[model samples]
Target chain A: MADGLDIDHIARLARLRLTPEERALYEGQLTQVLGHFRQLAEADLSKTSAPFRITVSDVSLRQDIPGETLGSEAVLRNAPASRDGQISVPRVVDDEA
Target chain B: MSESLHTLSATELSRRLATGSVTSRALVESLLARAKTHTVLGAFNSLDADDVLRQADAADRRRAEGKSLGPLDGIPVGIKDNIAVREQPLTCSSKMLAGFISPYDSTVAEKLKAAGAILYGRLNMDEFAMGSSTETSATGPARNPWDKDRTPGGSSGGSAASVASGLVPLALGSDTGGSIRQPASHCGLVGLKPTYGMVSRYGLVAFASSLDQIGPFARNVDDCELLFQALAAPDARDMTCFTAAERKPVHLPQNRKPRLGVPRALLEGVDAGVRAAFDAALEFYRAAGCELIDVALPTAGLAVPTYYVVATAEASSNLGRYDGVRYGHRAQGALNPVDMMERSRSEGFGAEVKRRILLGTFVLSAGYADAYYGKALLARTRIRDEYLKALQQVDALVTPTVPSTAFRLGEKAADPLKMYLEDLFTIPANLAGLPALSFPVGMANNLPVGIHLVGAPQAESVLFALARQFEGSHALANRIAP
Candidate 1:
C-alpha cells in the first residue's frame, strides 16, 4: 500500500497547489489515511463472496436510443463564454487545441 | 396540556389538517417562525421563505377545494443540503458549489411536493456527504440540539436535529454508510435507509452511488412509515431505482412471534453501555414475544473496508462532475481550464472529501484497480451474501446502530481512523445494501443509544410494524434519555 502511494506525483496530478508547508502537512495526513487502506489491502479477500441473494428492484435501464436534441439554445445559452454554437473553454491540453 | 403547536409529529399535524384544526398557511407560518428563531440547530443551509409560503398557501387553497388530502399535506419537511430543490443552493455543505442553485427538483423533493408537504428549508450536512461527522460540513458543524456542544450526527445531522429539536415534524435524509441512521441515533429520532434503490436518486448529489439511499427522519415510527410510503415509489428518472411491483408492501406478521437474529459475533467489540442497551432491547422484545436467534455473519468484519474502497471509488467518479464550470463556483476567474479544475476542486473540497477522492483515484488508477477496487467489490458480495444467508433463518437482524453514543465533538475528529471505525456497526447495512432503521431504544450516560433493525430486502414494513409495537409499549415509551 505504501508503494502504491506516490504523494508528490499524485498531488501534482490533482493540481492541489499544496504549499511547501501544506505539502509537508498533507504528507503526514495522507500517510495515516493510506495506512488504513493498506491494512484492508492485506486482508485475505479470496475466501469471501458477496451476497446477491436478497435484493429485488423493478427498475431497469432502457436500451440506448439516439435522436434526442438539446432543446433550442439552452445548451449553448449558458456557456461561461461561448463562440458560434460552441462552448469556448481555455485550451486545457493538446486535445482542446 | 396539549403538545406544543410546533412539536407535533407529522402524523398528528396531518390529522389536524384533515380536521381543519390548523390551516396550511398557519402551520407554515409557525414552522417558519420556529426555524428562524432557533437557528442554532444548524438544520438548514438555505431556505426560501417565499417559495415555502407560496406552496403552503397553494395547499390551503386546494384544501378549500376539497383536495390536498395527501399524507404529508402542509407538513413541513426539511431537505438535506445535498438534495436539489429548484432555485435553492445545493451546496452539499461544500464551498465548491457555494451558490449553485438547482435547475430542477430532485425526485424526492418533487414527490414530497406532490404530496403537499411544505418545504421547510435545506439542512446542513458533510461536504458531498463524504465524512461521518457533521463537522466536515463546510458551512459549519451542525450542533446537536440536545446539547449544541455535540454533533447532531451527520451528513443528515441537520435533518435529524431539525426534527429532534421540535422545529419540524418530518424531514428527508440520505444515508450512505450511516449518514441518516448514525445521526438519527445520536439525535434520538427514527431514521430509515431503504434498500439501495428503494428511493429514486435522481436529484441526490452523488456521494457513493452504490451505497447512497435517501430516506426519512421523523419523530415517531408511524411518521417515518408514512414518509417512506410517500417517497418509496419508483421513478423513471433513476434507472437504479427499484420498482413498486418488486417492492411488496411491508406488513406485520399476524399471530406470529417475531424471530430476531442477534449476531453476537459482530457484537463482541461494542461498548458496554451500548451492549447493555442492546441487551435490554432484546430482553424487551423477548418479554413481548420475539424469539431471539443467536446468529453469526463471518464476513461482517470486512464491511467497513469494502465500503471505503467501493464507496470512495464511486464518490471520486461521481464528484468528478464538479469541475468549476457549467455549475457554480468557478474560482472567481481562472487563468485556464486546467487551473480551473485544479484550483476549484482543491479549494472547493474539504479535507475529508479530498482524502476520499485521492484514495478513490488511487484505487481506480490502472495499477491498483484489480487489487483495491476489484477486491473490495468481491468482499462486498460476500458481506451482502452472508447477511442474506443469515436473514433466511430469521425475520430481521438487530444490533446497536453505532458502537457508542455521541462523544465530544472533537473526540474522533483528529484521528481519521477513529472516525471511520465509528461506522463499524452501521457500515455493514450499506455494504449489504439492505434496508435498516435506527430507533432510540434506550439511553446511555444521559445520551441516546439507537438500536438498529435490519430486514430482508424491501422488508421495511416489517421493520416498521415491529418498531411500532416497541414504541407502543409503555415501558419502552417511557425509556427516555435521563
Candidate 2:
C-alpha cells in the first residue's frame, strides 16, 4: 500500500482549511481510499494505452467562431460582492507576508 | 385522466394534451400539489408552484394555437440541482452553490424547453455528485419512496424518487459513475446514461467531466427513450457532443437471436437477495430466447479504484473555479485573497466533497501523479479493452446495477471506502464511455432490485431495446410505490 498522504499539504494545495477534527478524520479516511488504489499498481498494464490518446479523433472539437455571449449584468448577477460592475475579491500583495 | 396525470408517462401526457383531455396547467398543478404533500421525502431542493403554472399555461396556449412542440409538450420534468436552468438555483445540494442562480440554461434544459417540456423544480442530489447515496447533500437526504428509512440511491436520488413516487413523470439527471443508474435501480425506475458525448454537457455542473453524461429517469422504457431523444442532439455549444452521423450504432443481423454477455466475476459478492433476483432475470432473458454468454473482464475488479483516481483528478480541476470571486458562498473576514478562497471552500463544501477534492489534489500532485493518476488511466484502458473484446461476442452485458437494494440512511456514509465500493458494478461503463441503462427486474424484501444492460460505445438504442424487452416481460416494470 502507498504511504500515508500528507493531509496538510494536500489541503493547502486544494485551498481548503480543515479543523483539527476534520484533519484527523480525513487523514484516516484518505489512507483507506488510497490503499484501495494500491491494488491498481499490481496490474500488468505495460502494453495498455488510454483510449483518448490512442484515438484522438474521438473528441469533437468545435470550430472557432464568435457567438453570442452572456451580458456583463447576467455574468455579475451571482457575484458575492460587486463593485463598479466587477466581482470584488479580498486585497492581495500586502506589504508583509 | 386528470386524477392520475401525475402517474402518466410523458408520451401519455402528450397524447392527452393533444386530445384536449387534460390541460398542462391542470397536470402541473396536480404534480405541484403532490410534490408539496410529499415534502417528507426531501425530493425537491427548490420549487415554485407559480412559475410552474405559468410555464404550463404557455404550453396550453401553444396547444390551443395548434403549434405543439412535438411529443414532450407541457410534460413536467424535474431537474437535478446540479444542472443549470437559467434563473433557477443550481444548488447541487451543497452550501457552496446554495443561492447561485444560473446565468444560462444547461444544454439539456434548453433542449427540453424547446421541446415544450416544463422545467420544474430543482431536485436534490449528492453534493457535487460524489456520493452513492444522497445523504451527502448539505440540503438533507432524499428519502426512498419505498421506505423513508432507507436512502434513495444517489446522487440522482431526487430525480429517481420524484418519478417513483409519482411527483413527476420524468426528470433529468447527470450520471458520473452510476449516479443515475444506481438510484434508478434502488427506486425501481428507468435510468439511462447515454454514451459519453451523446448528450451535451454545456450547462450541467461538472463533477467528473469525462465520465459525466446527462440522462433521464422515468417509470418505463418508452418515457426514458422519449426524454433521451429530446435531449440528444449535436450542440455547437458542447464540443464533446457528437454529431448524429458520427454516433450510428453497429447493426446486428436480422433473424438472429441477440447474445447477452454475463460477466461472472463481478457478480460474485452481490447480496443474496440481489443475486436471486439477478438469476431470475437471467432465466427470464433465456426463456425469452436471448443467448446468454459467459464473458470475462479480468480487470473489472480495478474499476472502483481507477474511477476514484480519474474522477477525483478531473473533479479537482473542475471545482477549482469556486474561489469565491464570481458566484457561490463566500467567506467573511479574511486577510488576503488566498485566505478568503481557503475558508470559503472549506466552509462551503460538505465533508465528502472536501475529501474527494483532497484526494484528487494528492493524486495530481507532482510526486504522486505517476503512481496514482497515470496508473489509473492505464487500468482504465485495460478495462475498456476487456469490455470491448467481450462485447464483440455479445450484443450487451447484463449485471446487477447495485449489489443490494437501498440501504438505510447513513449506512455506508461513515466508511468512505465502503461507499466508493458501491459504484464498482457501474463505474466500468463510465470509464469506457459506453451507454448503459438500469431497470427494475424484481422486488426483494419489498425493495426494488435493478439489472443494468451495458452496450457498446454509442449503442444507446441497443441498451434501450434490451431494457424494453426485459421491462415488458417482467412484473416489476410498472409497479407503483406504496
Candidate 1 clash pair list: A49-B381, A49-B382, A50-B381, A50-B382, A51-B381, A51-B385, A58-B243
User: Residue pairs in steric clash, candidate 2?
Assistant: none
**What is the DockQ (computed on Cα atoms) for candidate 2?**
0.68
**Candidate 2 interface RMS:** 2.1
State the DockQ, from 0 to 1, for candidate 1.
0.39
Residue-level lDDT tens digits of model 2 in B83-196: 989888888999999888888888888899999999989999999998999999998999999999999999999998899999999999989999999999999999999988
Residue-level lDDT tens digits of model 1 in B290-311: 8899998887787777788888
Error of 2 at B46 (Å): 0.5
Name model 1 segments beyond 4 Å from true: A13-15, A48-59, A63-88, A92-97, B1-3, B249-252, B474-482
**Predicted model with the maximum DockQ:** 2
The DockQ of each candidate is: 0.39, 0.68
Q: What TM-score against the true fold does each predicted structure earn?
A: 0.92, 0.97
Which model scores highest in lDDT? 2
What lDDT score goes with residue B435 in model 2? Answer: 89
Give me the overall lDDT of model 2. Answer: 0.89
